[model samples]
Target chain A: MGSVDRKDILAPQPTAVSESVSPALEIVGLSHSYGSRTALSDVSFTVSPGDFTVLLGLNGAGKSTLYALITRLYAHRSGTIRVFGAAIDRDPATALARMGIVFQQPTLDLDLSVEQNLRYHAALHGLPRAVTEARIVEELARVEMSDRRRDKTRQLSGGQRRRVEIARALMHRPRLLLLDEPTVGLDVAGRQFLLQHVRKLCRDQGLAVLWATHLIDEVGDDARVIVLHKGKILADGSVPEINAAQGTPSIRAAFDRLVQHGEPSQ
Target chain B: MTSETVEIGSVPATGPIRLTAAHYLRCLEGVVRREWLRFLSQRGRFFSALVRPLVWLGIFAAGFRFTLGVSIIPPYETYVPYEVYVVPGLAAMVQMFNAMQSALSMVWDREMGSMRVLLTSPLPRWYLLTAKLLASVVVSVLQVYAFLAIALFWDVEAPWWGYLTVLPALILAGMMLGACGLLLSSTIRQLENFAGVMNFVIFPMFFASSALYPLWRVKESNLWLWYICELNPFTHAVELIRFALYGEVSWSAALVVVGFLIVFMVLAVIGYDPARGLVARRGGSE
Candidate 1:
């Protein structure tokens, strides 16, 4: 079960010329609406391998809608979403196979054990039994959840449940991991732990991560930030770049300036 | 060595992950196993599914035995007992209720966000929906068999070979009814409105069919009602089961059941299609 290496699980190989050149994820002219309500309009961004990108938005700024489009939960009428250069709409299985997502709401079955939840996900992704078992152990261990594999998810703490969900997302060895407001409802310590863990994954495993959140504090100096406001992107760059562009000393101040200005500052 | 040993030597260097036939089979197996596990854990659901049919059989059938007159039917050479005549209908009843219950579980899954986990799978939406539909059918069929066993113990007996013949019929009927439930679940957005939906759907489907009375009996009383019974897919399903349980075959009924199954399943797949589905129209609110 432990024969497979941890780094080889989901890491995009640099040796593949085609894959190495393509961004882990790219969205162009992506727009969506529900009847008259436009959730996202002309949103575009790209995340390279090993990049920890933060999608910062206020409560109704269309972050969730964007995630929905990328995950193929809802089909977008305008624009293309590509994963590892494969267009999601044209080649969904290939695109989706390279991606993993942790939605804002908890998606685990409370009645099932942590291992059971992970096993079902592995099966859905078409992982063989040997590979699934090996990856389950490796991922649970990564989240420091090896001891609670057999326990029902309902028995775990809020933070522990979130960790298990993260572990489950990794079961398929996705090169691009998308998390939507994963820190919501967690304590400060839990939030910090989760943020640090994901950041570590980006640095250690060279995986492209898109973390969407409304909280500005989740942004770090080394992270790239995409600020979304009222169905549009207002800013996209590193924290320092955003701060310099907005003439502010910090990301919070830059965020305030961007929200007040309400214009693209890419 | 610990599980974390980063041995990059044996890992495949580069290639798109390809899915095989075995993977699709495993996915189907996983979906069925999850349903079975959930059903076993929720003992109340199993017992309640049994009780509904048992109550109709034990109390309603006994009370109506003296009042209702069953004449010589095609499956029977002579007049048959009311209990015997109603067993097929009662068995179909179990499936109808179970199908609706499974649909309600889909609604619950959507509300709770597990449906999103399922939809995000790389598999085609139709295959995933079919797997889910089949899972519900398996559970419904189990309950139907349990009900049949109890009925047999209580003297509502069929031919020995009839039991074996009825298996295919039960599966077809279960799939048709379960597909209808899937269609409802996909279209009906709010869980709060589900009870009203269930009442509007279940009672009409059960009462307007040949489940309770023969089509001729319904025609004798009301011509329009008889037309509804004849048109009802549930009626065809019930007749198919009845014929099979009598060591006979109803090709017309079988055809109707198969046709309805295909139609309902196609509509169900369309209803769950991510591009034009209710979930898409609502923009993932549920």
Candidate 2:
């Protein structure tokens, strides 16, 4: 795995509007359920501009459920969801417009060429014809899949398909990117490659990011972490804050203590 | 016991559901383009749709010719051949297959995780479904017209102007079947259960309609059964085409076909609404 520098990964860049105060995404009291099953109950958090926010949880801890609500896959039964100060339900188009999402499953059509898939996404965001021609080329180049653009998705390896999916999601240049376990099916090298590229994009472009996964090792000590368990926000703070609370210096130990015993490390 | 007022997943109370037609159309167009490409890649799909009709017309109709004699119907002026009588029905049959196959694909879409991508769009669910219906209708119409051209070349002919009127008839029939497809797509949760549903829907719709023989031919058996054929929406769709090909109009058939289209479309929209959770797959770990 490639080591990404914290400074380079969290670089603060220019903002046309003042960025001293408001965060990129703000969620408050967002709760939802499936039938009698409470999937997410009163979860709340905030992600600042250029902040690499990683959500840590166990299976059935509501990471995917929260992802569903945030991306508007499954609407929230209650609570406030705001992306760049705009409410998701009030102005869903504008809220969704500001965000790029890579779903847990690969949504690319196996029958269509990689270029065709990118073109389809570009059109969905209402990109101009003149700009689309340039954007498609630039995007594929960024993911290092330019040569394979002409090939159908079924022909590509799993890692290649994942890379193409990332490239396609970035075509709109969204202010925030939501990655729901984007690296699940990738190997060690492939995962590290995607993570490095994503970290660079966030630092260079000042794009806010929410990376949800059940594994604690996926995130670094400096990144903001939220612990979700049994549809509740168990903890929300920087990694050191959680470590301090758990009486341990490492995040993995703190996470293990919180998830296994539901208490701070003694 | 009081009915439980259980509130499941819903939109945050602050934002209203606002989705414009134009934005919805764009997303729908992208999905339809992908689906069309998938359909084109499959070779076996052609055998059931394009070749199946020809087989029935050439072999079945020719064999039945010597056994059963068909009388002239409203659109026919004299003792017309049985093949000609079945052509309009065959055209309607193409539309039926188109609608159900699209529904079957929707079930497959759920299995493959593609449907969730489309549902996640910011547009309202109703508009998303309308776009899907329109795409299926367009594909169905193209296939129907292709069949018409081939039948005409074989001397199963109608008035030259009949082609123009047939356009509206095809659209009406397409919407009727397309709406039904959307309903089934919403109701069906698993892909394995689709084959049984397809057999149930397609056979009843085709055999009950005037597509195979004249409605009068069945009237001789039982007036009640004849009423069922008369009231069948597929029959009206067929009659709509039959009259259109003869350069005539059947106002009653037009009304019935249009009426069902609205009802089926409404059910499709409601069934897919997130609040209801009818089409929502059960939650699971990835």
Candidate 3:
């Protein structure tokens, strides 16, 4: 796969079945292991552009292992990742350029201001000075953090920090945003706020988002939720569809069904 | 930016924080800057880096001067003062400290959750590690120059031309130690176990090398000890610095240090490889 075309992702009108549709993210037969312990095994999925897809898994469910492979931090022994349709393994830079990632871990410099952190990230992508400053301001505003630009990241609350991370992830205005547990430390309010903001960002920016989380509440009925367990994806489909198959109306019940049965449909 | 947000103590949440290539460089740049700030914030690491070398140079060298009367080595054209002879060793000491500091920070980073942030960046691991190594080497060079300055003040002098040669020697020595540090950081599974590994690696490497005494000096005690010195990469690092400071090239020393450097770096790269889990631990995978 190459890059997902702008027309495929953004066109207001739908085409016939014969019309080609390109996915923003495509992973097939992905697997990773440390010694004999497999972290991810033959995970396959596609995230269409403008779609908000949530990856549901418990702690140690290989969400990060999959994220690592997608980012190419560690290569999977077998499988392929295509971001915006470009092969991540063959041409990582181009593939990576089209995607934004917010690691589950806090990657910010506590001592530096929020703006400085974004500036540093910008330079890594070789962004020009004027463009970086402009994007920093824009992204900060998007996260409702425009005023916190100068404050040291260390001073920010956990929720504020995660917002900064989300903003930082979007600095390049990527087509796909890969968020690994973006709300791990937040309170109920914080989690709700972050999810709402991220959902809005996807809508406003036409970004395909792969949100990894253990909380079933984070996955909406409209979003595509892939249930991962013990390194394998147990189910893949719309949350409502999966829930219906499991005879559960709520996402929490659906998740319980999937975990109990080890498959959504069965 | 509002005045409230701009307050030094205040944590601002102005607009959003965005990530780009520039942002990544800024992250690394920020790390280097913060490290310098934190390092300088406490005068302890600085003072220790300086004081330890001076203690070795002033007290130990002085006491040993009488008992360890030195003969002419091939590198030294004429008989040199014991202090003068150990200058290269002191240089190696600086490099060693710098390398250990790099390793020490890796442990600290793991503890502080900073290393995870760096690893998870979109940037290549090699580039990130290179930035760190460069910063370590630069800081090490500064410490060495400060030590040299102190040596000059103490009237322990090398040939003027030797100062120029010290630059390359410093680079090689810094790399040798820095790479070793990288390898150790990559291999050691956790910060808690780092001290044991440090003890295993640092003391042996230091004592086995010519840093404390010349190869010939050890040869008099045991031929195997002399062979150990030859095999000790730190010895070559010391020899390289020693020869360079004295306006000569020891081809064997150069070869050993460079070879050690390449091997250390290769090992480090292998250790940090994503598939290998060298530096990738399991404690904080959320």
Candidate 4:
């Protein structure tokens, strides 16, 4: 954040080994069904490094389903999810090692202290105890919950819990971060903070990010967007590209046109 | 949540990709630590686990003390008190209950989707599940030993060295029961559903086994019922503990318990497989 320029990271650097040419997340011919009801039908997309991509979808639009497949929470039944070129199913250890996720639900253990929850995650990643303690302090400080680390998660407010969750996601320094409706229940300021915080990670660290939300306003003017409706991709491009495809000037209009007609204009 | 602009430390530029034996060991240690903390927090579970077995040993055994007499069993050198006869059964009961209790928690986690946190780990799923089982076994063993210690005051005791010998038997039994719980948990979807399953599993497993009386007693009463008792894995677990407590080994019981453990553990691994097993069908949500 100090003296780091967004424009500097926006461009590719030859020296960055972390910035592999491969997409951070690549899903091809991904189809998942819950019995007869098809949740996602042939869904596919790619989130590149340093890209702030928003998965825009309404309720039951299969945004969560796509997240499930990518995160390996639910298996990829028909297609493939590759993280940093590592297929999740074939080599999940390698694939998952490169990605971090914040599930929509509050997955934190309410009974444990905030610090304990984070430590547990670190341990799962195989971090040493010495490193785990330091990382816990550092991440808690980032979420501004360092003081509340000792308190049980149940004692935290909704926004506080969300912040802790975000902190937990960063413990292992994942190259790609996936957040599903991360700001669903937060206030305006809280939501704004989360969106901006993640955006900065993209701009500053060259991290790939996929932010799934139904709120169109969260779709920034310069961000890439994937509009999912009824488990199919209606649009996948930058704000201007999506807007131009629908002959709309703004993201809201383009998203409205895409959702209202239930068809991809392009 | 703090509204202030909080600065996370600079990203590592590259995330670590290498893992070693230390990582797996750390994970195991962490799981054990979490399980121990949770066990400590749930004092009621520990209390109930002990009280339920003690009731059978104290009231149930005492009531049948004069009415029912246990003859000289191979594990027993001579006629032991009814209280003594029921000790191993009660210990096995503790482990079985612990297994189901741990299973209940797993089902809760899975239903709530919090289990995804553990499942998403870079570690092998089977290893993670085994770590969970072993952790539960540690807690179950603690309860079993505690029950044995308290039974001493009730004038029900094994040889002084029997307590030491029973450790492995207890662990093996705990693992066997825990594996069964894991296999069951993968099929279950709701917390409420677990209650019915628990009753179906725990009661029948306890009563249909040699928990209360010897298989010989059941054989004298009803031949078919005795066959069921003989086939019960809980019976083997109890016998294993009984023999181990007496500084001996029940080879047939040991083999059966070991065989079931392998079968259950393998099925559990399969049941949780996202692609091939019921895991795909269980949580059909996207």
| DockQ computed for model 4 against the true two-chain complex using alpha carbons | 0.41
Superior candidate under TM-score, 2 versus 3: 2
Q: Estimate each model's TM-score.
A: 0.93, 0.88, 0.85, 0.93
Q: Cα miss at B165, model 3 (Å)?
A: 2.1
Instruction: Check candidate 2 and list the clashing pairs.
Output: A76-B10, A77-B10, A90-B15
Q: Considering DockQ, which of the candidate structures 1 and 3 is the better prediction for this target?
A: 1
Q: Which residue runs does candidate 2 get wrong by more than 4 Å?
A: A1-22, A263-266, B1-32, B280-286
What fraction of the native alpha-carbon contacts across the interface, defined at 8 angstroms, is recovered by model 3? Answer: 0.20
Tens-digit lDDT track for model 4 on B74-124? 888899998989999999999999999999999988877788888888888
User: Which candidate do you rate higher for lDDT, 2 or 4?
Assistant: 4
> For model 2, how does the per-residue alpha-carbon lDDT over B217-285 read when each residue is reduced to its tens digit?
789888888898887889999999999888988899999999999999998887776655575445544
Candidate 4, after superposition: displacement of residue A41 in Å?
A: 1.7
Question: In terms of docking quality, how is candidate 4 classified?
Answer: acceptable
Per-residue CA lDDT of candidate 3, range A1-266, in tens?
22333343322222232435446688889887776777888898888766778899999889988887787666666888877556766656556666788888787877677987787666555565677788888889888899999998989999999999888877766777899888988999889989999888777656788999998778776777889987888877776677778888787887887788773253
**Residue A179 alpha-carbon offset, candidate 3, angstroms:** 1.6
Clashes of each: 0, 3, 43, 1
| Runs in model 1 lying further than 4 Å from the true structure | A1-20, A263-266, B1-17
lDDT by residue for model 3 (B216-241), tens: 77888999988977898988888888
Off by over 4 Å in 4: A1-20, A263-266, B1-18
